[model samples]
Target chain A: MKFFSLLFFIIGIQFASMAQTPESPAIVFGPVFGDSKLQELTYYKINDIDSVQFTALKFYISGVELIHQYKTVWKEANSYHLVDAFQEQSLSLPLNVPTKLKYDRIKFNIGIDSTTSVSGAMGGDLDPTKGMYWAWQSGYINFKVEGKSNLCKTRNTEFQYHLGGYRFPYNNLQSIFMDMPASQLHVVLDLKKLITEMPLTQKHHIMSPGNEAMLMMERVINCLSIKK
Target chain B: MKYRIIIVILVCILLSAFHMATEQLFVAPENWPETTYDFSKNPLTLQKVELGRKLFYDPILSKNNSISCASCHSQYSAFTHVDHDLSHGIEDRIGTRNSPTLMNLAWHKSFMWDGAINHLDVQALGPISHPDEMGEKIENVVLKLQQSKKYPALFYKAFKDSLITGEHLLKSISQFMLTLVCSNTKYDSVMRKQTQFTTQERNGYMLFQKNCGSCHTEPLFTNLEFENNGLAVDPTLNDSGRMKVTGNKKDSLKFKVPTLRNIEFSYPYMHDGRFKRLSDVLKHYTSSVLQSPTLSAHLQTPVVLSSNEKVDLTAFLLTLSDKSFLFNPKYSFSK
Candidate 1:
């Protein structure tokens, strides 16, 4: 009788532990060229005339928050992630949320904040060795996209955009808010819309912080959308 | 009884450890202003300082391992490359401006002549990645440091992590730089009533107070403000100084007023190292101040000084040199 009671207690504990386990959800960022997925060093036909191949696409996503109704439900601590198109693991960011916390909206910044920009050195994704930092002027690069297009008349037909500026009149940090869909959060950044909208010939190279970077950042913000 | 003894031993060890940990790493000179460097973020440790000292002297930071911070910033010349008007870098590529002296940096709010770098931690990144300088990226520098046989162990000892990161790398370098205190000059001794200045020096001091004290200031020897001290722009360089950073015409030709401390050794003077002698610098203030739309307000009025007064001022300026800081074995390369 004692053994049977002990066995019942053990089974009860197992059942309780199973009920308490929470499944962690992730926010996945997908880079796509129109309908097809974007691949590094792979050429894609743009506007049927120009052939564009992306060599690199990386940007900083920081200050992540989940909003319920109008109020913030959860905020990631030290929330900064470098989403690189080349690295598969970096594309999906795991979020540790409460078991039953319900959030309707997801908000994040497309670049490092002004505060972090002047706060000296940092570790992890914000490290200066991440290639997203400008060495001479002292600021994060914010967003970097490099590619070769047939339309570009410059060296090797290349176009590089390193958009960043923390100071006023050219602060390129853009906040993105997406409505949470029924399924898991998946944000798609369509380069097709970006490449089509931006003039590839005249504005082929933008490597510093200025009016051009700010305008390019605005165009980058428009490229992000929640895929239904 | 044995357990009690063991507990007591453990407590003693822990107490001693706490005592050593609480020992101050950097102590400011008496009556000096609070340092602008935020030390709480990256507190100095002896191990880290030593690590940074090695990194400062290590040419591994350069692309071809030919140049280091010490290559431009030597210890003897107030941490600046003297005799070179324009400091050359890897492959003998000359930079646009002179390498500024690195001392009393803990009080400085910004780095570079134009104040382009906002923080000291990220200042090295500018030279490390400049095409004509070290010609290496911070990422590559980190990779090289990690692969180095000696650095990994040293980094682990200093940072307590074998894997080297840029944050730790920069912070360690900052630790070594912050330790470079330039106090203890003859001027400081006279101020402390330890000694008296010569009659000539005293007269020069009074004149300096009347003429140059506003911008050069005292103690740190710099007001840390930007000024265009009437230098005619070099058409070859076309360097616009602070105006390039701010994009404001009002800041045209303005450069950070460098510390007057160790002026005897940190020559040639000015942003471009144009003046080779203290007399030339004095001449510029008195007779050759090129009037500009954005010249410093202090320099708007002409400075009148006789030859005797210039000699006396030069004598007073020589008192700012601190030989102890120059010859300090602590700052010198260990290996």
Candidate 2:
């Protein structure tokens, strides 16, 4: 009788543990420059007029959520991730969503929200030491893309674009929604589309958050699409 | 069974003791509004505040190790840059605006003269990276702090981890700044009914309530809102204040209304430190207010104060200067 009771207790504990554990889906994001995957110091052409070499590309992807039938299904808690092209480990985001929930769409913000920006210093990916936070402006630089290009005017032939603003009218945080058929997904950030769509000569060297930053944010958002 | 029950009770007691210890770190003044800062994110502890105090006084925050936060914000002048109109930073580089006093910051919603920084924890970044200021990056600052002999142990004591992080650095600075509460002034004593103001001060108090009370407010001595105090734009600097942040025309010429708690020592008033004395500030309010499209509505009507009233008002303002806060050894350099 004692052995049978011990067996029942062990089974009950296992069932309870199984009930508590939920499946968390992982989503991987791959940044590519046109047909080629993004690599530092790789030269790329823009509209045959501009030849650019990118040295750094980093951005923030936050507020990850899953939507179904025009309603929200799952949202990741503390969903801020800093994606650095140099850091391969940062490309994958493990989302805490139940595998049973079927979602048709995925949505996220391209930058840190105003609430987080005002909430003070945070740890993990949101730490200011990540080189993404603007020390002078007291807000995160949502997107940082730096490179060298002979395509024209600045000294050292270097072009830098740091796009971010949390205030109204010039807020640079962009909401991105992509159709997803499976819980496990991959998103592509096409730099080719961004460089080709925007005029580099007039818009390069953007460091502060404003109208130019907003335009750059829109251009970056336009280039993001789900990978097949 | 007895041992299990005792273990559970001990855990409960430990958790409650931790709760009580955190509560003791932050002491909101009697009748003051609750602090705007969310303490749960960076809970206050004695060790963290001590670490913050050390960092505030250390010049290592600068690139060249010559300037610290205390360089511009000295305790003698209520943590403001005195004598100089514009703040002097690294290598004698002059800033665009006067360094504001650092007190009652836990109630502040935004920081800096133009409210450029929305949070207090991130405010250090403004000075640390500004070319004229500390001229250091947060990453480099972290690396330096990590390599320091004293900081690693301090970090371990405050955060229980020796690996220094930018979050820990910023939060510790905030912990010290949040403790800078200047509420024990004569004005506070009178308000609490523990003492009485002189007849001249009483008259000045009434005049202040009638004229400056709307923006300066009582008790805290600041409503903590941005306003255009009607100083004509400086042709040399042309600082556009809040308009530059919001990109809105209406916010032009608007600057954060500074607290008047320590108006005595924090001389050279206004955003640019254009006024060297309280009388000059009062004179501007009475006679020198330039009418502009974006001027504050409250200042549109002249603040009429007679010569005697000005002196009396200055006397009342003097009551706000707390000697205890200025000389508090705890807030001083921790050696």
Candidate 3:
């Protein structure tokens, strides 16, 4: 009788432990629009500006908040990550969450944090492995814009727009909110429009962060399309 | 001349929707802390990582495909080239600093002894394009990977497409590197309470905590911060460490703190590989640290140790050796 009771106690504990652990959520991010003809995220129509096929899209969601409807509700600030096309790999944000680890609402910064640029190698979206990191220059390509235009002085212009500055005069990370329920959310990126519509000059290859990096990065995700 | 044009062409072709590639999983070790990498944005799969590993070990990354990352970053010696102080890349070329050991990379916030490269996924591009290293163009590397027979299938499996572009190739290498975790040493066992430290090791551990543990932290054996441990600059190398990247006058001679875990095997210590033995390293810490504007406050005062203290610190460092990781078959040649 004593042995059976011990086994039952162990089994009971295992069940409780399993119930406490939360399932990892799926994270998917990519270009939401493939071409200009495919509608954009904002109210604006897709068109070429000044004869440049400028695709107006948004990715810089300055903030992403994680809200947990389960357990006791909580929240975190600046959770949305920077998305770069030329130098960075597609992002995969981890979602394995507990109600406390996540909140019913998730708040995140859209551009690179001022602290991260100077602090050194950051993991994930900040890791140099993503290729957007600049070793010689001490900042991230917060906003990466690369495309060709026949109308510019150069036959085809490849513009590299890296916008970021942690110090005064160049902080580009922005904030945006989502009506995503207190539950899990999915953020998609349609990269197709990014390359198709943009005023690019071959002379401008943005490898580092600056006003150009910030302004261009903001424009890319300014009106990012999302679904709950 | 041709290289510049190809970069332009790739920039244009990449804009096409059909050219976009998928990302794959770059999973972290179980029970380990959450990884800094965001794999969902660039999902993890088998193809890209294996290609990266193959590319890492292959000679093709160099100008002549003569010296691969494995040339300097061997699996043995904790992936650091042990023969020379400064790294050698292509055509017997000499780099300015020692090639740092490569392991537990997923957790590391920076790369190179000076914390030069910030991310692991993009770190390879440095060597591939470094003048004295691989000396190849990123666009050319893409062309080479695209031409490989085994890589096309590998790319498709990882990214769901047959194309092997630079982004896909670079991402694949990042995947393999992310899997290179090294945390199974005897020291880790002690932390987990699975075993006890030997008398010598115990004494050594105490000495380390007192002396070197602050900079060479535990769990990872490195704080992953840049510090001027105070070695005078080598005129020939003229390396500026973090200052070169940040342009801050206060950040001179500050190299990234290296992990002391595999110090026993990875000889020729420091960013410049100036010391050959632990004794020299000890002596430098005790007496040779050159006072500079950016010198770490910890080493501001001399580190005085007795002869016995030196031996104990060395012994404690040995416990960081994880044989399984150093000789793991998975990390070795694919064959």
Task: Give the number of the best model, judged by lDDT.
Answer: 1
* Candidate 3 chain A worst ten-residue window by lDDT: A36-45
The pairs that clash in candidate 1 are none
Interface RMSD of 2: 0.9
lDDT of 2 by residue, B1-335 (tens): 99999999999999999888876566788999988988889888899999999999999999999999999999988999888999878898998999999999999999998888888999999999999988989899999999988999999999999999999999999999998989999999999999999999999999999999999987778888989989999998899999888888899999999999889999889999999988889989999999999888788788888899999998899999999989999889997
lDDT (Cα atoms) of all candidates against the true structure: 0.90, 0.88, 0.66
| Chain B TM-score for all candidates, comma-separated | 0.94, 0.93, 0.89
Error of 2 at B23 (Å): 6.8
Model 1: per-residue Cα lDDT over B1-335, one tens digit each = 99999999999999989767645456688899989999999988899999999999999999999999999999999999897888878999999889999997889888899998889899999999998889998999999999999999999999999999999999999999998998889999999999999999999999999999999999898999999999888999999998887767898999999999999999989889999999999998999899989989998889999999999999999999999899989899979
Worst 10 residues of 1 chain A by lDDT: A17-26
Regarding TM-score, does 2 or 3 come out ahead?
2
Docking class of 3: incorrect
Question: Deviation in angstroms for B177 in model 3?
Answer: 0.7
Per-residue CA lDDT of model 1 for A63-122, tens digit only, reads: 988999989989999999999998999999888777678888888899999989988899
Worst 10 residues of 3 chain B by lDDT: B18-27
**In model 3, where do residues sit more than 4 Å from their true spots?**
A1-228, B1-34
lDDT of 2 by residue, A107-134 (tens): 8888999888888999999999998988
Q: Candidates' DockQ values?
A: 0.77, 0.67, 0.05
In candidate 1, residue B257 scores what lDDT?
97
Better of 1 and 2 by DockQ: 1
